[model samples]
Each structure stands twice: as structure tokens, then as C-alpha cells.
Target chain A: MSDRLPGFSTLAVHAGAQPDPTTGARATPIYQTTSFVFNDADHAASLFGLQAFGNIYTRIGNPTNAVLEERVAALEGGTAALAVASGHAAQVVVLQQLLQPGDEFIAARKLYGGSINQFTHAFKSFGWNVVWADPDDIASFERAVTPRTKAIFIESIANPAGSITDIEAISSVARKAGVPLIVDNTLASPYLIRPIDHGADIVVHSLTKFLGGHGNSLGGIIVDAGTFDWSTGGKYPMLSEPRPEYHGIRLQETFGNFAFAIACRVLGLRDLGPALSPFNAFMILTGIETLPLRMQKHCDNARAVAEFLAGHPAVASVSYAGLPSDKYNQLARKYAPKGAGAVFTFSLKGGYDAGVNLVSKLQLFSHLANVGDTRSLVIHPASTTHSQLDDAAKVKSGAGPDVVRLSIGIEDKEDLIADLEQALGA
Target chain B: MNHDAYPDNYIRGILNSVKSIAMVGASPVNVRPSYFAFKYLAQRGYDMIPINPGHVGKELLGKPFVASLRDIGRPVDMIDIFRNSSHIMPVVEEALTLDPLPKVIWMQLGARDDAAAEKAEAAGIKVVMNRCPKIEYGRLSSEISWMGVNSRTLSSKRAPAPTQGMRLSLNRMSVGGGDTAASDRAAKNKSEQS
Candidate 1:
């Protein structure tokens, strides 16, 4: 199944997912076990001490997950990848590898809720801090940086809110700061945008959503653009300095451009225990085979939905970047020229009651917590997901009580709009 | 007709009670916050029903997941919504039509909708904005245990972990979960038992 001069659909179906050599199975098989056996002792030490790259444990690597990692890296235009348990895990692992406690990182304020919580609350426990910056205003990043800052993060297309980050601007800022710029590409899912092509040093994804396409599996990946110079960074001793963990082997010296992925695998995954299951990896791969197709349809459907919601009598406003009048449309065109990703928010005229009524009434759209699925999802942020925050914090996050978010699926445009119309009682 | 009075005052009381929460966006996916929060809250013994229309009949932690709140049949005290903000109106409407309107409408960390909040508040439902129930449970319950030095109160001179003598695991003492109101309950309950 190796691709040969194939299109995205063809490559997605074939790339890195060739027929199983041992079993000759057409579909990817789940390698559901803990440890892999070594042929010999020297081979074992070579593996344990990073002398060779081979699977030691399911936590570090799995053959099934490897296919997914390789395929996503290939699709995302990166040299290598590390598949982890979830997107948040990829972020935490990347930060842990980059920072040595007391370190800071600049991040776009309009990020996914979990990432916001992780940065503000969880990571603080580890002594890692995040300074907020607007991706639209890249200079905010420079102002936030200090001697201890290790990275800058921005979403390729921020979730639920289609805010396209100017990757080139942020990447330059990261380069100036001597740190890698990590981009969360879950919403864009590689078909619509490739972060590395725009100067990103590393890219992360929550395969649970768009990348997995069908919403059946949950996975996350970290891809190395192979651009960051680990040896010269001086900030990351884990890569530049000798590794006591692996018989004092220098990661940067041993694994040239792909050193970051290796670090993520050998140290982060091994310690964090947030490894992706082989079953989930197989499911994600199956889903990605339809990534481009699904994403295009999703974008179209979302744009249509966003338009209808904006124009509807019961609706107050919409936030899709595809809409010319949208605040983010310009950035979307600049960053996501092909199309803005398929998630957006809108307000209802009746406020909270209308929002709640719409969720129960929508016959077509499913009301769920996640986005980027094949079917549309709706949520009232005020009453549900963001309710724990104070009113001030909620305002800062752009989740006011009256707003509703839609993760437009790859469904028929008319059906999506019709559902909204019916839900809105127009 | 003041919309601000929509939720009966004392939002905390509406949210606090013998509870089971059905998280609509709950996933087994580790990358998603819903998975962690669902599992964490479950570990704390809140009956969590993971309702994803995609996996309607399937189970995450072996609990039957009815697709929508409409499918859940009986009333639950709270429906902790994990969905996006734009889509909340329908869920709120469904809750309002429930046999007994849910006591509270809990939005997850990133979720908010003003119209939906106003509607819910107008219906005498308490609205808590941009917060997670799992986090509140952790902070409010004595379960937050002993957070280290940083776990001290944000403003008050008194430390939450009074003794400073005991050690705290990261999970037992977390920063976001320690709302003062919930902590007070945890303390009162503990002292009464003693």
C-alpha cells in the first residue's frame, strides 16, 4: 500500500500503511501488548541506551502507532512524529522536554479550553509558566518573553473559534526567542493547512477530532519539522547536554534533525505513560484516509452553517473565518488560504434560554463536547463547558453566555442549515 | 422579567446535591479534557454517563451512554455540558423541558453562551460560567487534600493547608478546584464527622 506519486486521497489510503509484512493483512492490525522482544543482548543495550531505534515498549513505541506517526508526519510535511495518548499529552510532553521548571512560554490566548486549563493550572504545579499573547498581534509574544521562556504555542486554527494564527509571524518570534513554536493543528488536520510549511518548528494534533475524521478513536501526535537546532539552543540541555538516562548519549549528536521526536519518545512518553493504544492508532489512520475529503466538505458545510446562523432572525452573530465580514477572515485567507477550518461560534437573540432550547431542538446537529467530528456538534459555553470560570474569565475566553459553537461536519449543507433553521424556529 | 434573576440566586446550592452527571462530549481520548475530567470525577464517585451520539449505546467506563439528555429519561440534578458554546441553546431547552428542570447548568472550562445562560437563568436555573465541575468538586471537597506551598489561598492570609506539616500529592491538592465555598463545605463535613 505504499504510495507512488499519488494525490492526498491516494497517499492517505496508502502512505506508511502498506500491507502487513508478517500477516499480509490489508487493514492495520492492533499490536495490543506491552513489551517487544529483542533478538540479542547487545541489540537490547543498543535499544535501551539509544544506540539503535527500535520498539522497546508499547509506552515508547508501537508498530501500529508508528504507521500513524509516519503517515501524519508525511502528510504534515514533517520529518518525524511521536504519537501519544492525547493532544494534551503531546503538549505536556513537548513542554517537559523543553522546559526545566521555572521556565516560561508564550501562548495565544484564544486556545482550546483544556490547553488553557493545563497551562494556567496543571503546568504551574511543575513550575512551568505560560504568558498569554494574542496570535493576531505577534509582538505580544515578544513582550511576554523573558530569559527563561522556552517555547511559544499557537493553534493553526483555534477550535470552536476560527482564529487563524499568523504562523510566520509567531515562528519568527519563536526563532528570535531561541525556542520552538508548537502549533496545534487539530482543527486544520493537515489537509487545509501545514504549519511546518509556514515556519513552525513542531506541530501537535488531537487526532480524536478532525484527523480521526469519523470520531471513533482518540489520539495525539507531535511532529518535528527538523528545523530547530537543538545543539545550539543552550536552553535545552536534555537535547544538547549529555543524557544520563541513556548512558550519557547526546540526543542532538546522535539523532540530527529528528532529535526532538526521539526525546519525546524516549523520555516523555516513557515517563508520562500517556501512550496511544494501537487500536486507536489504527482507527485514526483509517479516519485520516478521508481527511482531505472530509475536511473540504466540513469547511463548506461549516461556512454554510455559519452564514445561515449569521443571517437568521433568531441569531445574533457568527464567527467563521470563511465569512468575509468575520473578524478572522483576513487572517484565515492569509494563513488558511485553501479554506478556514470548520468550527465557529455564534450568538442567539434570546440569550441563554434560546441557546439551550436550540440544542435540545436541533434534530440534525448532535450536542456534544468535542468538535471536528464527521457530524455537527453544538454547545452552549456559558451553561456547560466554561461554567466553572468566573464571568470575567469567560469574557476573556470569548465564551459569553449567549454564544453557541458549532463543529460543522461533512454533512449536506442544506441539512445542516435546515436543522439550524428548525432549531432557531424561523 | 429581569433576565439576570433567571437563575434562582445561590447558584452553588443548585449545583450541589446528590449527583450524577452525564458528560455529553466525554471521550476516552486522553488528549481531550473531557476524558480526564470524566474519569477524575468518576473516581470521586459522581455517576458519569458519557453521551456521544456517535457512541450512543457504547460505554466509556462501562456506563450506558444515552445519546442526548432527551434519551436519559429521568431527571439528573445537573448536566455538565462539554459541547461548544454556539450549540448550547437546544441543550438548555431540553433541560428546561425535563420532568424537573435541572438544578444547575454547568459549562466546561471553555464553554459560554450569553443567550443560553440568560435563558437558563430566566427559567430559574443557576448558571456558573466558564468552570468545570470536576475542578469545583476537587476544590470544594476536602478531597483537594494538602497542596504544597503554592496551594495557599489566593488572597487570604490563612493558608488552605493549615498545618504546612503534611505532604500533598498533586491530584489531592490542585489550584483550580479549590474554590473557597466548596472548601468550606468539605471542612464543615469533616468536622461534623469527627
Candidate 2:
């Protein structure tokens, strides 16, 4: 074997996977079963007591999902990872491990509409308060810190707008506050930017997006960077304190660097129970094998489309960091040098009516609520995703009435541009 | 120097070379991580000597407990420290006083002391920090995969058949007897009859 480490593309294909042990089949076979049989009573006891690592039930873990988890963890340079049902499920599992009742977590103001709703509403019920801070202003995050602050959350690339976040700057704030920096890397994916390298303690992803490439599956993952000292200050009891459910084993003390991921799996997934289907894990695994290739094409096509929209007379503004004139261009260059990702938003000169009209006139781009698919997708976020937010909140999230989000696909750039031109003209 | 990562070969070499391990801070309590590790290594055919000054006469899984490294009259191949990070320096100093110094010093998971590690390495001793021997043994032997944990090592070679009182070695090929087609067929036939 060579001393050299495997590259990103190679890891994307081969990490966390081998030929079927029994059948010798090449590709990973979906272990569709729900529970694994124990070797004996001793083996069963060992697994339940956390003395041994093995699958006991599918709700907690599965073989197919384990492969997906390891692949993402390797890609993100994380010590370990956990696969969950959806992007929202990933968020719940992650925060449940850190926050107690009445604890506060700082989150960027510019986030996905669904996330904003979840934080402001569902999380409030659980007494996990969210203090909003502007990603553009580093001081806003530092100012939001309180004695109760347990974590700082931000996205590597803001959804809808595709604006680049200053991860290192926010990470400094988290460090001073003795909190973990959690970055949602859904928009960029590991192919574009690895948040762990930028001081993120934990990275979350909606594998339903570009990682899956195809829009056929819904899955999410949490990657543990293994950087934080969870046992310090006794701030994170779920990790530092003895877990009563697992024979009073201290997760951080036993699992060490990968304890956060384990806590999420054993405590959060075990109780809350949003488990990823084995079939979805299989689909996402196949999708990830081609991530590097697909992501580059998506970026190239997106740049062409953004450029065309910027030149169009009917378009008032474009919010893609790939454009030289975009506000986040410099940060984009520093963080995601590969490309500025493929999902971005543009405003129509005629405002909301024009945005909705263009969506109807478009021939190729599918009108949907989702982003990051193999085919181009279009959505007027104000009337759809961000409709819950009032006028000022909508504009702040880069989802104004005139704003139309586009998730560029790997289709030929010229064909995409031509389709947009006809829709704008019509 | 990066204690967080060790080459697979380096870990494999240490595990294979060491025959007996004196585990500092070994507990009589069955729930403790130290007890779990001691029992596991003992089961894997290693001479596991438990050391605890507080429980000098107590035993874990039939292995007699010693007060400290000095109490072990025989030459120990390795010293597995299960103490806290701050308490490691004294333990390392004690291990160095042994007539024939241990070949390796292994710290339990979450237990790391850079200065102690440097001191041991200066004395020509191999040191592994913030890692669990039981997990490493399971991973290297491809035993962890049976429970769906990613061992992060891939191989195509067939696993050896099980024998009475089976003991898996680190050098064995990858195994997943739990998910094999033969097991699946047996399960299916049993379900059909029921």
C-alpha cells in the first residue's frame, strides 16, 4: 500500500465501503434488515452496555447507513458521523446533545426559511432559545453570547442567496465563549468546502441536496470534527455526564473525539427516532460516488446562468458569490475556491408578479420548494418558503418578493441560458 | 507527533508485540470502562494485570490486582494508563522505575498528556494516547463491523470459520458473520417454519 492518503474523489467512492463480506458483490449491498442477531448472550450484553460497537437495531444504526456515515465523515475530515432521516432531523439530534432547557444557541439571521421557522417556533417550545446574529457582522455574534450560550450555528453558504459566511471569524467568537461552532454545509457540500478545516466543531448536511445529486432521496448527516473538549466546564452534560440509559457510561470519556456523534446516535436517535431508511442510504451512497464530478458541472452551469441573468434587462440583481461583483466573492474565494456552489437567487425588475410569471414561463427549470437536484429548479421563495416571515424578515433572509431562487443543474450552460432568455422575454 | 492519528501499522505492531499489559486504575466495578477493557484483553488471550492502589486485593474477571507497577514482580510488556490527563505524569514516572521498562505506554480514551508522552518516548517507549485498546482490537480484527460500526479498513479476504471459544486476532481477514448470506438464509428458513 502507498504511504500517501487517498484524495477526495477516491474517498468519495471507496471510503466506508468494501465488497460484500459474504457474497463478494462489488457495490455496497443495502442491509435491509431492521436488527442484527447477537453472537451469544455475552455479545448481546456487550453491545447494549456500549462495551462493543455493533448494530442492535435499525432505529439507532444500520450497515448501509454506517457506510454512508463513514463516507461523509471521511469526506469532511471528521472523526465520525451519524446519518438521520432528514436535514431537520439532523438539526434536532445535534442540538439535543448540547442544549438543556433554557440554554441559548446563537444562529445566523440568514438561514433557510424552514430552519428559521423551526428555531423560532418548535425549538422555543423545548426552551432551547435561539439568539440571531448577522453573519456579515462578526460583532453581532460576540454580542449575542451569554452565560447560557452553548453553541454557535452558521451555514458555510447561506441558502437561497448563496452568500458566503465568514466561518473563521464566527469560530473565534465560539472559541472565546467556550462553545462549539456548528456549520451547515448543505449548500457547499464537502466537494466545494470542508467546514471542519475552517474551525467548525460539528458539520451538518441535508444529503438530499447536492451530495445525493438526484432528488430521489431525503437524508441528513452530522459529522463530528472531534475538536471540542466536551468534558470541560461541564457545559455539555449529555456527553460529559454519565448517560443513565447506557449503564451510566460517560460518552465523552469513553468514545473520546467521536463522542458527540455517539451521543447523537444513542441518545437523540434512539429516543426521538427519525431514522434514515436503508434504501435512502443506498441511493445517497451511489449519488455521493459521483459528487466531485457532478458538483463541478453544477457550478460551471450556475456561473453561466448567473452571468446571463446579470446581463438581462429584466433582472434587477443577482446574489451568487461566483460573480465577481457579488459582495461575498472574496470570502467565497478564500473558503470555496473550487466554485461558489450552484444554488443562488436573482431579483426580477418587475418585482413579485414578474418573479411568479417567469416561474410559469420557464420551460426547463422545475418549479419546486427544494434545491440541489440533478435538474435545474426554480422557486419564488417569498410566496413559498419564506411566506411565514413578515416583509422585513423576508428581505433580510434574501427572499424578497422579487427574489427567485435557482438551483443550477449539470445540463449544458448554453441550453440553460437559452431557456432563461425565452422566459424573461415572454 | 500527532497523537490524534496513528498509522494502522504502528497500532497493529504495538498490539501484536505486547503479550502482557498492566492496566493502571483498573476497577472492580463491572460498569467502569477500565473493567470492560480489562475483561476484553483477558478474553483475547493477553495477560491482563489490574493495578489499583485502592483495591489492591480485589480482582477483575479473575485477574489479581496489584497496588502499582512496582508490585508486579514479572516484566510487563505494556502499561495501559486509565487515569486522568493531569495524573499521567506520576503514573509514567512509576512505570519508568520497573526493572525492565514496559515497551509501550497506552493511555485510555480521553486520557492524554503530551509531556508524559514525550518523557516516555525519550525513554524509548512507544506511546498511544486518547485511544481505547478494546476498540482498536475489535477494529483491527474486523470484529466491530458485525455491529455496523465503520472500522475504516477495507479487505476482501474471507474470515476464518468460528471454533469453540473463538478468539479473533488482529491479523485475521475482515469478518461480518452477522450479515452473511448464509445467516440470512438460515434466518429466512427459520421464519418460514414459524
Candidate 3:
């Protein structure tokens, strides 16, 4: 009644959750059921025909996941969102709606190595060609735009390196090319940078990262900004054309702004069958309640670690945008004013052996392929996550043999600094 | 004024306030979206008037059809435009000519014309674009949740079952919130037993 919109922290806590209707449980209860019972034959028929909204099967939707979807949608300022099994599943589902077989999508060369692999191998086999572009070179995205291009993909903060991308510049290119700009906001999270606010039409996240905060759950979400006109030029037939499965209803015409989320749900997730478990959704939802507090600490701790690494004798350079001397510092200030995020790469003066040795010598930092945990994580990506890529590809993705990627967690800054010092010294 | 997202209260207000609605471009065929919306709203006890040049002499769901807003002969509470975006300006201009202009001008899903919305809003008419009333009604009434749609609203209170007919109310008390009188009583009773 006050006409005041809820603030970020308030929305984070209460956006999509309510006390139980049947029981008074304050926390979101895991429905934990596969299918929901209908009132009668008409209710079942309406749901199947997309004439009504409700839970039919777990593969399509669930109440617990709906709450998570709404919470993320509210946080990102998007019209709707869909939760999936993993970040890779979110990408596959998102692209399935946009790209047909043989259609091409332009992507930033610097990305999560897993994503690069998926785009190159898995997507390629489906006839979805990925045209690589340089995120640092804005014109490269424009150049990669061919008639067959359906979408442009980038990261809000590039993985491993923690570099900032000029989202507005690429958004201009996407607007000109008549394509939606899909930004992977997994690294930055909504607490730091909301991609939708920076001209991203669709924002995807690996909820295993900062959003879940604790890194205890593996989930992914795709938020629909509802900015792109999918019906324009009839380029996106999946939305504009009638969907054969749902009684020939055109999604864009029926659902309007949230049609992309609906298509990803009814078409992609429903068929592909990579639905997030109710328990995982509940775990992630609990994690998100503390997102604002945890994300800030993660940023603060990361800055301290980056500064220490930059001054260390064994370190050649720190790639965190939080450092003033970093190449992406200005862009980071413009886009993520709060902080440059936690995951960043640093190179060792001792080269590949030193990078590998430091990981084993670390006391507190866990040497793992994952990031965005409550505990500090260190990874020699070149030998692990990015090992499949060739030498040039590895270096291009900021996972050079000498580079060490650290996901600084919400720990005592001095303790984190001391651990790095002992490891670098040894 | 941001048509991209409308608060729940704003939409609930429009649906609650409006009684009679004239749906422009309404179709007699059951397959069309306009027909579905018209049928749904009619069943919900609204004064639904269908307006279509092609279906002027026909009846839709036991209601007579008129060719245009001008032929309705009675003032409407709202004008639901189901036409193409390019065709909105003329229909809005016609709505303004009525003795007591409609309280709202609603563009159906995928039908948006910002210029027309602005013009109507300037004349003291509320405008909502690129949305469907049927969806909003089901969403606000928690009827859509029966089918598993994310209404983006949370309520712990169960919606009251229809007493007589298969109709739900837009003016229901449980629009949002988990802590309602019924839910509170249920919680209190459970605690006592436990």
C-alpha cells in the first residue's frame, strides 16, 4: 500500500516465497513429488493445452522451483525465469529456442572452458555453429554477425580472469543485428552486476556459484528480461510460429513478454528433461536468502587477495578487475560498481610448475575446479578445466599454463593472504 | 508507465473495477485467442460485448456482436483491443468519442502501440499493453497456479471454492500474502494440537 518498491535485500529474502498454505512452514517446503493432482478432467485438459497455469509434472514445473524462478526474476528485474539442472543445461535450453539446426550464434572467445567445449562440440553436432568473437574488441562481435546469426553471447565477467566486458557496446551490435544478447552472469551475480540492466535481453547463471552462495547446490537459471521482440521480422519462428505441441498456439502471441521463459519450459525443459530437483531448488532458495551478505564479503576478500598476489615476488600479474592497474578496471567500475567479483586469474613468475606447485602447497585454499564457494578455491585451469583446448585456445581463455584461478571466499583477508604467501614462498 | 512490468495491485485494480468490457476484434471461432478470452470473461459474470466487422450479425457465447465500438450503443467500462498494433490508434480514437470514455484501454497479448497507449493515458484513461486479462485473472485469483504457472505471487491462503457456479472472483481477499485470517487460524489450531 505504500507504493514503495522492495529494495534489493528485501527482495532477496522474500520475493517469491510465502508461508505454506496447508502448513504454516515459513521456509519453502520441498514439494518432492513428481506430479500434481488435478481438480478434474477440465483442469487436466486446460493445463495440457497451456490454457491454464499450474503444476502438471515435475519435469515441466514445480511449486518450489516456481518460487526460485520468481525470486531470481525479481532480483534480476526480469519478467520470468526458468530453473534447470545445471548451467550447461540452461545454455542448451536457451539456445534451443533461438537457434535451429545450421543457425549460428556469436560467442565471446573468452568463456568458461566447459561452455566453450559445449558450444564447440555438443552444439556443433546439432548444426548450431558457434562463431567466436573477441569480447575486448567490440567490432569483432559486429563482424561475426552473419545472416544466419540468431543470438550473441557474452559473460558479464569473464571466467578465470575476472575481466569486465562492455555490455552496452555489444548490446548496440545485437540491436543492429536483430538478435538478443545473452549474457552469462554466473561470475558477477545480480548482487554485483545485473546484465538485464545493461542491455542483456536474457541473463543466465550457474546457481552453483555466487547466487547459491554456499556452492552446496548445483542449479542453473535463465532469466527473461522481456525486452527483445521475438516476433520482429519473424526471425524467431519458435516463438512467432504456432507450437505444434500446444494446440498450435503461438507462444509470443499468447504469453507476450514472458514467452521465451515459457518456450524454454514447455518446449526445451519439458522435452530435454533436465529439470532441477525440488530439494536442490529448496537448497538454492535457502542459499539466496543470504546472497547480498555473502556476495559482498566474497568481493571484499577477493580484492584483498588480488592486491596481495600483485605485490608478491612469485606472482607476475593479477588479472582481477578490482586492481586499478588491471586492463578491465575502468569497465568494472562502470558496470560492477560494487566490486569486480571473486574469481580471477594470476600468473606465477615460476611458470607452469610453480602454478601447479602453489595449488598443492596451499593450506586453506582448496584446489578444485569449482568457484563461488564459502571456502576459498584454487584451480590450475590449463591442466584441468581447460585441458581439452589447444595451447592457443587455453591462453585465449585466460587459462594459460602459468595462470592460477582463485575464487576468493568470505574468509579473513589476513588468513587468505598468509595462505597465499606460504604457498608462493614454498 | 513502464509497460514491461505491471505491479499486481495495478492489474488487480483494473480487473476488479471494470464490469462491462467491449473486446474489439473478437472472433466467433473458438480456436482464436480473442474467442477464448471472451468466453472466459463471459463465464466470470462480466458484461462481455464482442466487436468485429466480420462477426457483426453473429453471436459469441450467447452474446450479440457489434461491428465496432461505436455500434455498442452503451458505454463500456473498458475496451479490450485484440487487433494488430498498427490498428490501435483508430480504435482508441473511436473509444474517446464515446459519451463517457472507457476507464481503461487494454491491448491483448502481443498487441502494443505505445503512441496509442500514451494518447489514451493523456485523456485520463489507464492503458495496459502486451498482456492478456484472462491470464491475469487466473494468475491473481490463484486459478493459474492450479495448472503450475508461476504467478510471481505468493499466498498461504487457499482460494475459496466457488459456491454455486464454476466462477472465481477478482475481488477475493487472498490476492497476495501467506498470513491471512484463515491461514492464521489454521496455524493456531495446529500449534494447539501439536
**What are the chain B TM-scores of all models?**
0.67, 0.84, 0.84
Each prediction's DockQ against the real complex:
0.01, 0.15, 0.14
Chain A TM-score (model 3): 0.99
> Candidate 1: how many backbone clashes?
78
Tens digits of per-residue lDDT for model 3, B2-59: 6655666788888888999999999875556886788778767789999988876779
Docking model 1 quality class = incorrect
Per-residue lDDT over A21-51 for candidate 3, one digit per residue giving the tens place of the 0 to 100 score = 5676778889999998888886677567776
Candidate 1 chain A lowest-lDDT run of ten:
A1-10
| Highest-TM-score candidate | 2
Q: Candidate 1 vs candidate 3: which has greater DockQ?
A: 3
What is the C-alpha lDDT profile of model 2 across B84-153, one tens digit per residue? 7779999999988888999999988766788899999999999997678987887777565443344555
Pick by DockQ: 1 or 2, better one: 2
Superposed Cα deviation of residue B56, candidate 1 (Å): 71
| Clashes by residue pair, model 2 | A54-B147, A55-B147
Ranking by TM-score: 2, 3, 1
Q: Show where candidate 3 strays beyond 4 Å.
A: B1-10, B28-31, B39-47, B52-76, B89-102, B112-129, B138-194
Compose the digit string of candidate 1's lDDT tens values, residues A261-304. 88888878888889999999989988988888888889888877
